[model samples]
Target: MIAFLTSCQEELDLDNPNAFSLEELLQTADGFELLAVGVMDSYQKIPANEFLLIDLRSDDSRANAQNGVYPDVDAYNMDTNNGDAATYWSNNYATIFRANSIIDNRFLAPEEYQYTIGEAYFFRALCHFNLVRAYRNVPYLDKVIDINSNEASNYPQLPPSEVYEKIIQDFRTSIAFLNGGPQNRYRPSEGAAICLLAKAFLSQPNPNYTEAELLLASVIENKESFGYDLLTIDRDDAVNFLFDADPNDPTVNVLTTEEYRANQAITFAKIFGNEFTGEFSSDNLRLDGTFSNNEGLEINEEIIFSIPYEAINTDNVASSQSGLDDQVETDAEGFSNAMTASGPSNGVNVATLDLLSLMTPELQPVRFDGTFRSITVIADDILNDTFNSKYHLLGKPMGTIGLF
Candidate 1:
């Protein structure tokens, strides 16, 4: 019986043909590309709690008094126990770990994948940049920390100055490795690296204004080569909608209400693209409608880099309170509640009174209307009016979009 059991154990010890070691998998360009994609996937979580840390503390925005978690943030009294702060810290480090994997193993990859290494450096720098800015003294993690070793202790929290130095160096390396323009706006590029480097220079303890200026100038001078430009609308073409009056006629000095709306609609389409609706109706009334949850103005030349999100079904959205030991699902395919929350009463982030005072239709006609809409509520014979920012709109799961 003992000899038979020994033979069975020996048979089970044979290598599983289906399994591949990390070393074997990473011996090709495709493997490096896969790692780079993993880095991006990790980065998708970094922005999840940014609104709580940055916007809520700023004067332009505030937290809903109703949302218990963020009122401390809005009051500038958030503590170490804050969940949002903890989440932000973890998300950044998670992204850094994935990025470091590609960066540390770059030499093993083919020369053709150097651009992917550059992207890894860019992501690593970005994570550290955000960390130092938010937490001041933070560990500048360049390589993945081993769980069984003293690697974590080797990277003690460094001063903001030292952290900035590492961030700047990583950005410089990224710029050197990245070549040409961006093939995909969703990915990093040489231009993106240069811009980020310039921003880092300005953001550090001692701002290097001269270097930043030169870098920005180079970007502006070579904007066409980088495939970047402001989205523009032809004024003459817009004026042609003026009541069918000769657009070239000098006597047509005034625009009728319908003509004015048509001109505004033209401008809106140019900026937001035709994917958006609900601007104006046949009766010249503004309708409440959701923007298309697809790649619309996101592809505009003005966009430098943007994180993309799909409009996933509400049922697929992950719960925030899943068990720690269990696999905590994330809304990786959809927008977070920060941008898609229903309204001021139910949402955590909202425009402050100070910002709302300046966002009136009279003060900012096109800009205000495009970004915000007002809603009034009545309770107990009292009327309450609130201006819901575009981010607060319901059924809109559009992800974060960044413009130059």
Candidate 2:
């Protein structure tokens, strides 16, 4: 009986190195979900250079804070050959690597894993979309790489248009493969692929707005499936709902009560009085309503997707310790909460002024009572708007945008 049992176990195919049968993984889950996770992970794992490119080019984060090696508080024209160029060139390649790895691997999953294939298509397309946007030209590898002869270095860059063709195809395939389910949401659902497809087409210098319009329409129609929408709550109301109000005596150099109250009465309210209520605050209504307090903002019925910050993989603080030459010149430990948290514990890295300026729009809802007296010289009303505007862009007016 023992011999029979042992033989049965051996015949069960339980010891395959590939989790599922080699044939099942290739046929079942495929590589979609793996690729999707890779695309998502790339955003968080971006290096300082790539971060600079996106942040500098982005609308609000350009003027105030930054993490670049150089602190250019002023509006200096960026040359593609300068530091900005290096950032653009490096980050897109990294994204490509993640996408490529999945395409080249065997995704082992049970035959029942149908959604897996859809996710892989979505991620590969997402990576290409981002790459084409940043680099203008990138390699489009549809087939698995040959381990024997072909190396990454041997691969050549394709024209941006060619890359776009592959990107569009991947997204469309993703939409078709995914049968619209919530399980897909945690990964890059059809919704994310559609969003990416629309973005990819739009980024073209001479875009086909008709196609873009159609894609966006699909996004709206199936919005509920993917869970994308705006939060209706006032910024302050949402904050109150999310955090516990543990009003501690203001930190040693914190804003004074009189100042806090006066500022709170203005158009904006103070952000510090209320503590985190276990809700994520990453995508607040700052710039285009995408900015948030914590790395992952969870506003009411809104939020299509939110990326959680992993402390270890997060961009590191190069200069938090005293006497570090590269540390930001701020007398205060750190300016932004992200920097502040990293500074004392790990190390602090300042967000670039270029990113601050790029993300800054003309209007926003801000925490009023939380003014930095040390940073602003003007009246609260004038500075209030500036403060709110800056915060909305994920920055602080510790120094004027023009200070650069």
Candidate 3:
């Protein structure tokens, strides 16, 4: 029994070759890359509640009364107990936590992987910026906190003024660390960091217009180096469609011509890079498209950063069946499930009447049609109502405020 116990003790004392500590892993370049991807993944969840939290509270959009917690948000009567607000707050902090993990251990990464740390700083600054804009006073988390440690107490809620200072500092740090152009439009770049820093300067309590101007001027002057350009339609092409005509007449050449419809289709395709079909109608509602497929124009030079989602097929069966005959498939990440008028839970987000009035077809034809669509509902053999579409084409929501 003593010999067996000794042998067991010796085996227990031996180190397992397969085990790798986080600290040891972080010392390599690949670890930093992996952690940077995690920061982006956490950011993906931040946009799920963006329309509910931001746009619904504004005059440009309103929430459907039937959806959960959205009507309260649209009415401006939402309190601390709001579920959407809580989820937004939690998602932002979760992203900050992942970013902090990379930032805190940045020193361990090799020289080539330093840009990943820069990306982390950019994301951390972005989350804090959004939090401060939405909730005003927020905790600025600069480092990863241990549950058993006193680090939680170290970061208390700070005033917007102090939080802006930290945000500016982080953006500057990110700019200093990042180099060259973006690897792709989906990843962070030095130019993006610079542009964000300039915006931060303007967004703070005391605006620094001069500094912001200088930063923006540098970016504009070096725009070609960063592969940035404006996506514009030719003046002649727009002039061919926009003229003084009775837009309601389907027989009118300007409104009903194939040339005009083709131009609108091309404009939509350029902006969204999605498949589209055009039609001429009496009400001047003509364009239809789905934002599911990409036509390579999705990653144009104008885009600084964006989130990409591909259609995923998933089983829709409620219970297991003995054969494949009972299986049904559906798009797991389809925009139709969340934003389309034909969606199961439609009207979750729709344009306010005021916004729709300002974007009439006669006044702003291209802008109006590109931003919104109208769906006519028929009931009892008559047209019941026409509803404005949601901003479904604005893929992967970005942080924006009314003041900005």
Candidate 4:
């Protein structure tokens, strides 16, 4: 019987040579920093860049002019192998697992690195919140995972209601530690946690609106202290950045070497432009590049929390897994960049007529005195007898690549 049982199962050594033990990592300053980096990397990989999955699921977007585009998700076809579902499940779990590893190792961290624990709590809550939103149920993994245990693979999912309790708890833990952090906008801040926790409160089945309101009010009322505010762009720079009065201007057709240099490190370019392209135009918001450079842009007052995705050779921080692979194609890159006028440029998703018209006439939303913030980026679609107005095209890529 023992032989039979032994024969039924295969065993393999599962030691990870590259991994550091909790004790080993906290022994030095560099080790703690490495642990912090692990948390950030895990978060960055969470498939948040896939807008087709998220937007197609909503009425806000549809496939391109091509027929049967992203049809499974567009049609709400939740099949067993739904790519979006699988992506969310796998990515969220990976983030949760990383966060759990950090939480599990918190005791081993030196006092100076205690903020790493807080960051893990926030990431854990964020990942769980994403899963619950997508699936309405998930294996809320608050405990450290044992790779050797069969139960790890066969873990059960919790209903969102129960999972939410854990989410709240995690956020509270995050806020408690992060509230006393260095106040870095790139990482989780006390205000960011409060904002997210408030959002979590609102997302509940029986939403705690009172708490949400209080949390939101605290951020808004003390915006300066909370490290949040709208960016006040110079009038001429804002206009020059986004629009071309004359779309036929040859000089504006492609981004010149000078123009690219000016916008290279700017958030406007990082989010809207593709890397290493002479493809800058006033009408086309590709001045920065297709995959927006999100590194230092995180601290921009306009941003709350951002996932950083840099191109090759653009290491804003000293980390190994910090850049994106090239996804070059004949006309289109591998990913979608919607920060341009759809018909005239290589924008994949265009604003639907339903949305554009709603924003026009009396229904127009407010914009700054001399800014393109609320202006519609319309592209003429002669084939469809309608104009495609791209709405809010900035910051198309990223969802926190940092694992810590």
Candidate 5:
């Protein structure tokens, strides 16, 4: 465990569990790139830790009942403590810690401070943004304070709105430091900072959608220069997107800033964006198993963000179904849904039919399936038709919110 302890003002001695200091590291230009690497680590760690998060809000879970992933989203449920919140919080703070140490140094001994600080600010903002979105409130690291200090100990989680304010401040500061600098393949620069700032402002409650749309558009326009593209797993091409990449190779382009900024296909497809696989069984129909219709579309170019599942390397596939069959028994009294009866990889996280019906009502009409036929429909008929026409749905149920 690294600890930031007493050190000389000339040298910001970083107590890294790893064997190097930021000053010694900055001797090489590559050291400047550590900011980017730290961000990558923070992002990837989200899905790697089993207890981090369960995306109950996933498409698969929201589409069926028996397969409902969480059954409940209440914080104290068995699922809440699974590790999503804790891991995400830990990783984000870890990145912030690194950034704080670097920024605290008064000397601009290295050429990379501008770039590194910008990246650090961006990451700090990014972490806070995600934390707010997932957990609603979290502790804000307001100053450069020791992690071991009593101050750190007594801090309480702040409101989401305040977190957004700090995020905006951080991004603005980062942008100023970067000074409209050109972007790098793997690092945050002026453009990335601007894009993130736009995102942070727009994502907060009561968003300024006008600015958000414009920022998103800019990201779309500069995607290539920013080193992002909607990754297509060409069936004709030999490599699969996830497992084929050497995990340890730091230089690999796993995802790009442009894709992230644009909310492109990859961003929308995030089963768990940073995790290596979508939280689904690789062999189940959603991709390779029973849900062939959706899975076929999922693995194709339309999918913007997905981690591949490799049954061969159990650890490598962040989500898999190797041992679930025995856990859920099927019998006359048991739920006879597709998920439990199928297999471990095939367990269902069913979403209410209402959601699917909202997307495409004609396809799933009343009495379409004996068990699935709508029991009741409530809502103003006129408004329903208007929304249906706008979204291209025939009808929708009242009070419908999807679960993954």
Candidate 6:
């Protein structure tokens, strides 16, 4: 009885050295926000592999080389155990797990931290939705798996419909809590929730066009309040899109700044603007005065949700920062020096000849641009941005949003 009483008085309060107390971290002032930022940052790491699956499968692109996992994904011969499949699956789920942690302990956060919790829900919902779409029947993990608890081995591999239900549920939670504009363009807002919810509603089994329509309308009507707008180009500020050996040639037929600045002309030129021109006079990037008044760039208004890269140039500058993105942070001093050091190109996956003719002069939906899909900067080098078209299914879910 004495020994038992002595044992009862002892307490063990040892801190974990090998594991992070993510729950405790969530309770800190900036911890919830960092959790949100980490989720967003992880998204940036996915584009490379994500592009491979969507792009190479399409008629537009082919394997860069016959080696590595490229050929496997290119030919649709990827097994579940394949390197590419495993990599993509692992990366996405990592983000999902982080989100699950935030959601599992909702009470730990104060009422003031709703926005942080909302972002987690939004990210979690998005991660699950994409996994359902890509992997079909996948293991939907609601909470972090306990290795010692046998839960890891017995995860529920449910159908995509069930997955959709999970996604919609999380989205409802996100919409309820995700208020304010955004922490940044990368972060989700109420409008982001609405946009994604509409997409989710449209993607379900029977589909819910009415609900999708209403949600999309709410986002579209109040987009300005959410900090979204169409970008404009001034006729005087537009750059000439021609490879004229002789600048003096008058009769030579070439597209000019005047034509590109017109309401009807394609805005595709924005992708291949003078960001690579090492000169201070270049970088027609309008991003809140990152460059000098002489540089001509004013700011970017059209981009609603583009991931940003660092402006401090290392090996990767704006051009080297893969496929398509803006330097959302305005530290252009490194950018200018990086440009001057190496006049690198922003080239990406090559498009098919047929595909080029398709989107060259202007963008899609004939109501928007009937003529050209792109402008010829040089004979063979028509400037273009490589958006994965195989992900057309992604756009297909937006059936009503585009029309409205």
Global lDDT scores for all candidate models: 0.65, 0.44, 0.65, 0.57, 0.44, 0.53
Q: Estimate each model's TM-score.
A: 0.78, 0.54, 0.75, 0.67, 0.51, 0.65
Residue 90 lDDT, candidate 3, scale 0-100: 85
Please give the lDDT score for candidate 1.
0.65
Estimate, for each residue in 1-404, the C-alpha lDDT of model 2 and write its tens digit: 99899988858875756554423434543344444455555533332343344443444333343434323522445654575455445544555555555445534444444455666666567656656766677777676555366575688889887788778888888777665645333465666667767777887666778898898797678666656653333433322212233366433233333322222323221121121222223254221212113422312223333332222222553221223242322222133332322232211233333433443323222332222211235542232213221221122212111100
Give the higher-lDDT candidate: 3 or 6: 3
How far off is residue 391 in model 2, in Å? 9.2
Q: Candidate 4 at residue 388, lDDT? A: 31
What is the RMSD, in Å, between candidate 4 and the native fold over all Cα?
10.1
**Top-TM-score candidate index:** 1
Candidate 3, residue 295: Cα displacement in angstroms equals 4.5
Q: Rank order by TM-score, top first?
A: 1, 3, 4, 6, 2, 5
Q: Which ranges of candidate 6 are over 4 A from the true structure?
A: 1-20, 65-68, 181-183, 232-268, 271-299, 311-348, 360-378, 381-404
Tell me, what's the RMSD of every candidate?
6.0, 13.6, 7.9, 10.1, 16.4, 11.0
Query: What TM-score, to 2 decimals, does candidate 1 have?
Result: 0.78
lDDT (Cα, tens digit) per residue for candidate 6, span 2-25: 988778664443655654467667
Model 6, CA-based lDDT: 0.53
Candidate 3 vs candidate 6: which has greater TM-score?
A: 3
Runs of candidate 4 with Cα error greater than 4 angstroms are 1-23, 48-50, 65-69, 231-299, 312-348, 365-396, 400-404
